[model samples]
Target: MTRCRLCGSEAMASVVDLGATPPCESFLAADQLDQPEPAYPLHLRVCTDCWLAQIPPLITPEETFKEYAYFSSYSTSWVEHARTFVDDAAARLDLGTGAFVVEVASNDGYLLKHVVDRGIRCLGIEPSVNVGAAARDGGVPTLTEFLSPDTGSAVRAEHGPADLVVANNVYAHIPDVVGFTEGLRALVADDGWVSIEVQHLLTLIEENQYDTIYHEHFQYYTVASAIRALASGGLALVDVELLPTHGGSIRLWARPAEVAGEPSQQVVDVLAREKAAGLQELSGYTEFSARVAKVRRDLLKFLITAAERGETVVGYGAPGKGNTLLNHCGIRPDLLAYTVDRNPYKHGRFTPGTRVPILPPERIAADKPDYVLVLPWNLRAELTEQLSFVHEWGGRLVFPIPELSIVEVAS
Candidate 1:
């Protein structure tokens, strides 16, 4: 992007240029495989002024979320994480039956369902019609609408101001960062708390998590940049928590400017860490593009060697990040026979640009492939245990990110 989405600056520097790829989640149907698939330049640039790394918003949220293929409930670990967060938040915020909780971009009511179970008043603001319907079917009070300043105000008026506003893994999704933060401000009561969980730029750079960089994520944030972004919309960062989810993420605790005091020591420490890592300068990003190339080369070499040796290699989980890894490495069905996922929506469909078939999770066991390339490597521990049955066939699991590593799962 020529200008920063979070800050109005033209001093953008290169972080990594991933060439061109289609929307990461735009899986193809069998009949539409022949149709021309469009691709966009998937380059990431960091603004020197604000230190916010972002890609151009070539595609809108509606294009991707209207009928999303991903369902949060499919990931057991993620559901448990949500449940733990709800329980902790309720006890920490002293939320009782009279307290109200609101979650933005509440996919399938994964988190809010816990609030409902606790007898707390809660509402979910979901954008996708299908997933929103699924949430309602599960007994969640949901509003099928995008979060804008106007929408936030309307919701606040209709159902009173929220005592707790929880936005997990969505702070980086919106293109208009300032407006979205304002919407967050409008939804919460004056003294109410807001918690946002987003992938930390520090972890993405250190762990070589390039697959998470896509058009859907308009911007990536370091704690220093996040503080500035939050201040732009009159929300003050009060505290911070380091989380292990999504490889590594940060949970920001904020409040209205009038009520928010000085940030906690945790925020100060994380900002110091980001600064020490040289993220705000060009030093930290110089070797990233090279590292990304290594990941692509290493994965391809392993796949090609397996093919030449007459060994079979299949993939596990058809996540959006997997599509990025597939397209970046130019992997096809030949390199990866096919991938399997727990989500039925992706069954029988093909990956966006890679065009690899997506089969049911059962296919891996039935086919008895020699190796299972784990696509959603972020969930390595969880998937490794679930796919441990492959040990019966002496099949191993392969992880391509954070350096290619293969291990045998013991039965």
Candidate 2:
């Protein structure tokens, strides 16, 4: 961390440290509970030179992604988001039967299935063995391998150059940002498009979404930094779209530098907005650590008060981000009881570091706790509607991010 991962600059400024936390997705099995668990420093720092916010590469991508527990299709809204993106991309890019599409880190073929349905050729390059197998079973042409420059060139040789390369929610995962960007450049045709969706650093700082900072996510991105990152591998940011996914995200539309003539007005406008927010300067990041501390204090206060009142407060969704919040707040099963998730893989497992049991989603309805503390608050709308049945038992949903708030959903 002495030198910035993205830029070779030694100038770094602190941006909230969550203390040492385990890899967020490393759920523990019952048998492994007695063994020693590992944790790493979960500190974020911003480069004054490049303005790319990053954590050190304490863990490798192989350790986390080889057998990933996260299956994208579990969330109905995210699947629909992927479907909508595919439809829009096909129409926008004029993708035909002969055209080719490729998605990197494509979990369970959620997005590429739409491309397959359109009779267009598509391939998914995924690193996780389990999820990649699921993608193949779902009729996607998937390669179970991480995307390096060589891997990208090999895929191109085998499947030909892709017309549209989709990389959603994965730009921040890689430690070798420049090499990964070059791999992306190798996969895409000279005239093709590359679409990437990542959580916006501007919104993250402004809205108090510090939970998204974890070892798995090596970097956070602003439009200004993102533009610089893209150019590392000869890609140009041609357009930009602000999205509400993952709390708040930016959809970066890029292409080969040769054909990427000029960026859209949207990109220009967003850059102006970022500049006004003081992201390029050190002003925006200096206060983030304090805000993050306030979040931890507020959440802990609420949970302790609930415990003292003799009211039960359980958690919903064992997402990776939730682990950060739980570990930072030092919440255990005593305060949270047990959390439930829709993913059966985690039903009998425990959250990494925090040894809270993960049970089935039905457990919430069966138990009818006084308050269901939602961990995946990014999926607020969909989860609220889905968990509204709790209202039948006079129960409510509590969201812990961007300040704690409780909602009484209509049954």
Candidate 3:
């Protein structure tokens, strides 16, 4: 009797199931190692009514984001991406000092810092205490609590409605997707716009990105699904932009009810394209389980062969996507000696489920393993360039998804 969170449809089918796994970001300290890691069912389902791809109800927001460990400033590309977003949003929305900008799940003030620099009033709603503190230190006013209808009303009572609300890569993390969007409607002014960026579900299936299936991500959205979800909260989609970040993503711009903006042709075109590709059809998600199985077999085989050959393998980027991949493939310290992450919070900790040690990138230079597995495959080019020194040891970079391959650095 599992119902769709968006459309209230009881008709749902299991699309892909990754089994039980630990919360992706729940990295553990050495002292905490003695405690057993809690795991939950990580299964995906498709709603027949709305065509929304999503995970079965399992964890809540309070459980997932409280005291979060991820800091966005650690990634160079993410920082630059935030900067570009601020610039583009400012110009597109004609925003200035008079306007107010609000970002939900504003991790470490990565994007708000730029908005504040332009003299615009910016507010951040971040549930993670440590990350919110970092955002405050970076000069962005942040509220450390989950965004809900009550919280949204309280924020509106104090600061009035916002001119722009930005939610980058956070739309999927919410358990009550309907309530979250209703809160967005309450916080935004009648004529104000809300922008949401999410990793596209179409891109995930096409690119073999089963790694993105984790408990933290409750929903995998397509434009059609998003349109339905937003309209349910009395919002309308006015524009859509395809972004290269996070492998492939869609940035959707929406406005409050009765407020109209020129709907972009890109929005119409993409919706039509998704329909043509069968995203709206029940059969579209039928083959996903098979695809996921193939990925698991391929990755496991590669890891087994590498271990047998005595090739030292290590992981790059302790991102949530990496956790899903590692846990699904049953990768442990035996297969991956350790993982390197730029985020200080994750450094010195061990990845959830896999329990592989996490260290700084400097470890790569010190250990010089025979192969470095790039987990954040979206940033393969950037990561490869950063670790080009592997060439000195005649080591090659390996990527398991899309396909397993060993790449040699050009001299």
Candidate with best lDDT: 2
Give me the displacement of residue 240 in model 1, in angstroms. 0.7
Segments in model 1 whose C-alpha atoms lie over 4 Å from true places: none
Comparing 1 and 3 on TM-score, the stronger one = 1
lDDT string, candidate 3, 1-411, tens digits: 288888888988888888899989889898888899899988888888888888866777788788888888888888899999899989999998999999999989999999989999989999998899999998999999888889889999999999999989889999788889988998999989999999998888877888888888989999999999898888999999988888889999999869856678999999888887778886677787787788778878877898999989998889988999899889999989999998878888999988999999899889989989999898887888898999999888888877776899654
Worst 10 residues of 3 by lDDT: 402-411
Runs with alpha carbons beyond 4 Å of true place in candidate 3: none
lDDT of 2 at 189: 96
How many steric clashes does model 3 contain?
A: 0
What is each predicted model's overall lDDT from 0 to 1?
A: 0.93, 0.95, 0.88
Q: Candidate 1 on 78-196: residue-level lDDT in tens?
A: 99999999999989999999999999999999999999999999999999999999999999999998899999999999999999999998999999899899999999999999999
| Per-residue lDDT of candidate 2, residues 1-411 (tens digit) | 899977799999998888999999999999999999999999999999999999999999999999999999999999999999998998999999999999999999999998999999999999999999999999999999999999999999999999999999999999999999999999999899999999999999999999999999999999999999999999999999999999999999999999998899999999999999999998988898998999999999999999999999999999999999999999999999999999999999999999999999898888989999999999999999999899999999999989889998997
Error (Å) of candidate 1 at residue 166 is 0.8
Give TM per candidate. 0.99, 0.99, 0.97
